[model samples]
Target: MLITDDDEGDRRLVARALKEGHLSCECVEATSIEEAIFACSEYAFDCAIIDYRLPGRDGLDGIASLHQRFPYMSIIMATGQGDANVATEAMKLGASDYIAKAQITGGSIRRIIENALEKAAMRRKLALQQEELENFAAVLVHDLKAPITSVRAFAVLMEHSVGAEITDKDKLIGQCRRVANAARRMDDLIDTVREYTRADGQLLSGPVEMDRVIEDTLSNLHQMLLLRGARVTHGRLPFVLGNASQLAQLLQNLVGNGIKYCEAAIPTVHVEANPDENGAWVFAVKDNGIGISEGYYQQVFQPFKRLHDKSKYEGTGLGLATCKKIVERHGGRIWCASADNQGTTFFFELPACPAIA
Candidate 1:
């Protein structure tokens, strides 16, 4: 923890009060903003308590600089008596909390610090939620707009060429196909979003039979596999502790993506598992496709993030995000390894079932 105070007596008083309050902290003292910055650079402090009055610059001015430097660190500004305006401005300038130095007590200071920490944590969580909501909204708009635009364009062409002497049969058929594909894309977006949200929060934990899940997933995606002429090969997969339905969905999404993104190449996907050092099974879903770039390895797992053109690869972009959520729900980690054109392998780990152990 960092404490900045210009007066030696006030600094000592704050330190003594914290000690009397029985709050154990590795406190670092700083007399000015520069000293505080140096201390912050040297150590990772949980919170910084700053005195309102300083020699060259006041605490309110320092709040902005400190906040910019360490945005996540909680800051509590200490103001003198009857300095309500200063306290208010400190908060506006990104101070987490403020206290009047005249009213300082051991218990009051401890409670204030605890309150600041709790509020800071809540703020960070809200920020993350807002960002996720914004990302979803942006993607929803783009995905929805693309299909509607395609449908409208095709409809306009068909209407203009209807009953015309120069009507081309092949062109009309091509336009109808485009319209049908666009409608399918729209329907897929709605279905994917519905299913993604439905299973997102539901955690069904059990001894999930790996073989049964794979068989069911393959059955569900059989049509797509046939349409794409994709072949899946797998060896013996071990049973693990997880939700059966979610695991099936996870594999289905991976396999579906593997087939869809192949760019005319015959899709060949392999599913295999091996035991890790910690008794957990590391499963890999390897696919021979037009692989993803190294920079987008993590981005592809984000909802509605697409590295390729939507026309080339038809999807709501929620498949990998759903897979990630499922893996996290099962207390596992997921990652990818791939080059630009060289195939990709997605690896995830799950704990072995107790019976198997």
Candidate 2:
């Protein structure tokens, strides 16, 4: 907590009130707005109380400056006289709350501080949600353009050759196939987007059997596995509390990625789980395929983020992003460890189901 008051008496009074209130905080004193800004740069303070009168600038100016720099910090304006105009302007300048000097008792101060902190937390959460929505919009616009453009171009070409006596039948057939493939890509992207959004919905949680999830996942990807000549093996897995379908989708995406990115004649993937020290189930999906570089580990989980060219590997690029959302929804976390040219191991931790009595 920071206390900014040019008057030494007022500063000491605020500190004493905090102590009397039994509020456990490391209070930092600043005599001016400049000092308060400097103190903030030096230490990460959660809340600040600024006197209406300062040396060079008033409390409203200080509130605007500090809010601009650290938008997440909670700020309270303190004034000797309760001027409604000043209070309204301070709020517009991002002051979380306003308090009069007469009400500087331990109880009132504590209540004001708590309310400011809660308001600040809500503002931060809303900011983060807005940022995520913007990113989602940008990804959709950038990724969907390519397939849509391809479909349009191919359709135009086929239309141009519609009435012309086609000398080459194979060429027209190839154009038709291209149009079909582009349409399929667009359909796949839309389906993945739906799955990604659905992961955020309320989970119908239960004791999901890992063995059954893996079995169903493999069955769903049987044709892809056969075509790629990939092998997926797993040990005796454990039961975890999560949504059954989502768990299946999570495993399917990981295993499919392992097979899709491999260059080996016969790709291989292994899934296993063990109990961690915290009694949670730590699961790993190890793959013997072309691996990811250390630097791109974090970026790979972002939506529509890809490391390879579309011609070489085909995907909507939402697989890992969807997996991350699913794991997080289940109150878990997922990450990967790998090196270039070496194999990769993806690890996720989930709560272990209690033993049946």
Candidate 3:
């Protein structure tokens, strides 16, 4: 916490009150708003208390400046008695709460500080959710445009061919197939969006044997593997605490991408896991395929962010994003390492399952 009051006596009084309240907080003092802003830049303080009267600027100015720079920090304005209007203005300037200097007490200050912190946390969470919703909406609209247009164009062509007496059977049939494929692509995109949304939900947690996850994933991709002549091999894997179905999806996506993006005659992918120094299981899915550039390492994990043209590689581009969400939900992280023309390896770490009693 930070206290900004030009009056040394008032600063000491607030500090003393906090001490008397037995609050577990480290207080930093600043004589002016400038000093307070400097202190905040140096460290991350959860809350700040600013006196209404300052050297050159009032607390409202400080509140506005601090709030603009650090929206996540909780700010409280301290005003003199009968400063109700000032308090209201302070709040409009982004002050979380206001306290009258004369009313400052151990109990009152503690309650006010607690409320401010809670409000700050709630504000941050709401902001993040709003950003996510906006991003999802943008991605959906942008990606659906091409497929939707294709469906409409092909449907029109098929309709005209059916009306023509001299229509070629093969041409009409090809148009109908094009329409069906476009519709299928649209359906696939919607399904991918649904899966991505579900990845953000509560995980149904349990011990998941990674070997079985690989078995199921490979089974799911059996046809793709045979068609591409891809080879997938894995060593013994450890058990992890996560959703079994999501883990399987994660691996399936990685393995499928390895085969889909390869230039090799026979793509090869290997999956393995080992214990890290942090007591987490680090799993790696390595592939021998046309590799990713260093520049696209982070971009690959963003939804609807495609590194290749859809004409060459068909996908909604949400696979790696879904993988990232699944790993994060399991209290882990995922990243990749690759060089151009060299194979890529995706590594994710999840909490190891606890030993049974």
Candidate 4:
């Protein structure tokens, strides 16, 4: 390990302290960023302790340079206790830990260094797991496309082969259509799960107009809406950051649930957004349908967890799960507020908009 500071005396003092504290860390003194890089090229190090105030270069600048070359190396920033902003910036710049220069004794410094090393190890393990999951998802999704394509091809052929003049043609065609829909649902569930479980996550979020997203989702569900006489209304809305496809899917799940569970009355769904106390945007999907029980709220978010039997609801149970993932990925939280028959409101919150365009 290397410890760099503009003060020669401080470097020696820290090195001696660490050595006495049973740390086998080989201390390298670099008063400037250039010296730090030179030391790194000259010898290998598991970590680097950078002082916030360095001559000719700030600690964060040196850390940035070091990170580009040695991303695996743990970085611990030394800062004055009063400089909270500097410490926060260092952490955001990927520093493993921040130590208050005045408060850190020799022993405390060693402990910090050890803790940083442990964190680095855990991060590496997470990276490996993420890679494995990505590889698995890519293969699984790609493999699924082949069989689904064949099934769809055969289904279309059957539809054409059976003439409309034949009796029971409508019934037979509807049954085949149902099978095709089921296959498509499976594909959608697999793709959504694959995207959600990603380690770095699906960074597909972009500027999404509120009205456009809801309009598009509802348009796609036009047949179902018409069949159930579901009315969806909205008012003036704000543009938010989100992925259009994922947003449409999330909406489809919530609104579609309302349509599927509606009793004798026409299904009514509404979408709206407002600002919360934290200044973040809060969106809620309200539905007038068979409402979910309070005890099932938590369970609904789990993949394939259904409150009603498959015969009654007619779902694969991945819709709400996908919604949960999408909301969480956007730095938001979602929960259901509802009473049976009265209605259900699924509310979700997204972080405050970026200050800049």
Candidate 5:
């Protein structure tokens, strides 16, 4: 920890309080903003307890400079002055917490430090979640607009054709087909968006049976599976600690990818599970179908990233991304490996759950 104070007596008092509080921390002392900056540059401190009034510069300036250099470091402002405005200004300048030097005691210092650390952790978590939401919204807007525009353009063309003297049966049929296709595209986009939003990382606390999840996912897409003439086989699977619904969604996306991205006349999908070196359950979904290119392996996991044309494959490009989000929420990871026309294999690892006694 870094402690910044110009007064020798005040620094000694704070150190004594910390010792009495049993807060075992390795502290480095700095008397001014420049010293504080130099100390921070040399070492990473968990938290900085800084005096708001220094010899040369305002304490708020120190807080701002430290914040720029160590964005994730927690800082608490300690000032003898009881001015409420000073505390507010210090906080606005990036102080994580504030304390009055007059009120400094072993008990109060301990509580303040604990509370400041907790708040800092919460702030970081919330920021990460907010960033994810923003990215999801941006992708949703960019991807959803294309289908909407297509639907509108098709609708306008149909309206104009109805009023025109072009009575050719083939032209009329083509116009109607275009409108129908556009409407279906819009419907698919809306459905995919709804699914993506539904998987909002709200994982439940329980043991999820992967065997049941896989079976249910296959059942849900039974019609599609049959239409594609795909044969899916699975070995004995394991249970994992996570939400059942989310696990099912993850399996469904992998299975669907296997069935859809096929070059074989009859697609073959194999679902297998094994234990990794870390004892995690590594589930692999292998498909004898058209494979993804090496260059686009990582890109395929990004939202709204379509390696193939929408004309050939019907998807909103959120399937893999949703899989990734769900797995991560369950404290797991999902990835794919494939080469062009060599088929594809998707592997996801989840925390292993011991068998119920």
Candidate 6:
């Protein structure tokens, strides 16, 4: 797992504890926050143990960066000094757990790592179960709504033929149609629930080129690009460590996002990537579409949330939320930068996959 600490003594202590406990954790050492992130490029680990007191960098800021790229990887902060307030801030900044440096040990260290790993496993399992339930509910709703829609259609046809002179026929048909429409909407919601809440299926990992992943993601969204008249361009990107299937889904969500909410005449989405000051990969998907309001920036990631009315747009609202899940699973964080009508940029950073020899 990713291990970062400016304290050489402390780093070794934690490493030995993990080893002695037979945790199978390879301690990748980092003297600074930037170096710690670079270590991610070398290999993708299941968790990250960071020093809350990294001397030069505030522990919380470092955790924020790591959390964005490595959302799925459990991270704990190690600090020698702190009250409840500092510990609270660390967790707010996305730390999975907190450990005081003075408290580091073989036995405690083993337990911490074990606990984090176990928690990750539990979350994945829960997601799978939840997706199965959603899929089942969606199917049930669809079956129930079919007859309602047919009834509404027949009512409309009779009303149209009978006209207003047919007494209560028009009003009765109108009411039936409204009820049918609501049922159809519930059907849509059920489907979105399944789409957004649906399990990510599964992922297969390997050394994949970034350009290839982008191409594949774009290919899947060919229909959206045509409909929205949005064009995307980016420079050559180097290979990063991750599952190609998961990465494709990641890009699909980003591009589909450009099509869904933007009200601009022509939407333009741009993709770019580069090695940061630290060697990790940072990629951005910028769009010249309708920008999201500041207040909704964080809320947009919440499941089943939409900034617009359902009448105005058709979506499961689970798209970006799902994107957030995928990014975190790969040890990355995702956030948006946008202003009214200026468009928005959804950026995420993932550590480059370590080169296999």
lDDT of 1 by residue, 27-106 (tens): 99999999999999999988899998887788988898998888778999986775778878999999998888876788
| Top of the candidates by lDDT | 2
Clashes of each: 0, 0, 0, 0, 1, 13
Give the better candidate number (4 or 5) by TM-score. Answer: 5
Which tens-of-lDDT digit does each residue in 1-357 have in candidate 6? 777888788888888778777777566788778887788777887888888777677678888998787666778888877568878988888777778777777778878877877876776678776885686466556555765666677677666757755677666667667667767766776665565543355655668798888898888888888888878787787788777777777888887787666887777788888778767788998988789889889988866667887668866566787788778777788999998888889988777878931
Error of 5 at 57 (Å): 1.4
Predictions in order: lDDT: 0.87, 0.92, 0.91, 0.78, 0.86, 0.77
lDDT (10s digit) by residue, model 2, range 1-357: 999998889988899999888899999999999999999999999999999999888889999999999999999999998999999999999999999998899998889999999999999989987998899889888888888899899888888787676668788899999989988988999999999999989899878889999999999999999999899999999889889999999999999999988888999999999988987899999998899999999999998888999999999889999999999888889999999878899999888887620
lDDT at 16 for candidate 1? 82
Which candidate would rank higher by lDDT, 2 or 4?
A: 2
Q: Which residues of candidate 1, in runs, are more than 4 Å off? A: 9-28, 33-45, 56-71, 78-93, 97-115, 163-170, 202-204, 235-241, 263-266, 275-280, 309-312, 351-356
Q: List the residue pairs that clash in candidate 4.
A: none
Candidate closer to the true structure by TM-score (higher is better), 2 or 5 = 2
Candidate 3, run of 10 with poorest lDDT: 158-167
Give model 2's TM-score versus the native structure.
0.92
Q: Which stretches of candidate 3 lie over 4 Å from their true place?
A: 12-46, 55-57, 79-92, 97-121
**Alpha carbon deviation, residue 156, candidate 4 (Å):** 23
**What global local distance difference test value does model 1 have?**
0.87
Please provide, for model 3 over 297-332, each residue's C-alpha lDDT reduced to its tens digit, 9 standing for 90 to 100: 999998898988888999998999999999989989
* Clashing pairs for predicted structure model 5, backbone only: 263-290
Best by TM-score: 2
TM-scores, one per candidate: 0.77, 0.92, 0.86, 0.53, 0.83, 0.53
Task: Mark the 10 consecutive residues where model 4 has the least summed lDDT.
Answer: 192-201
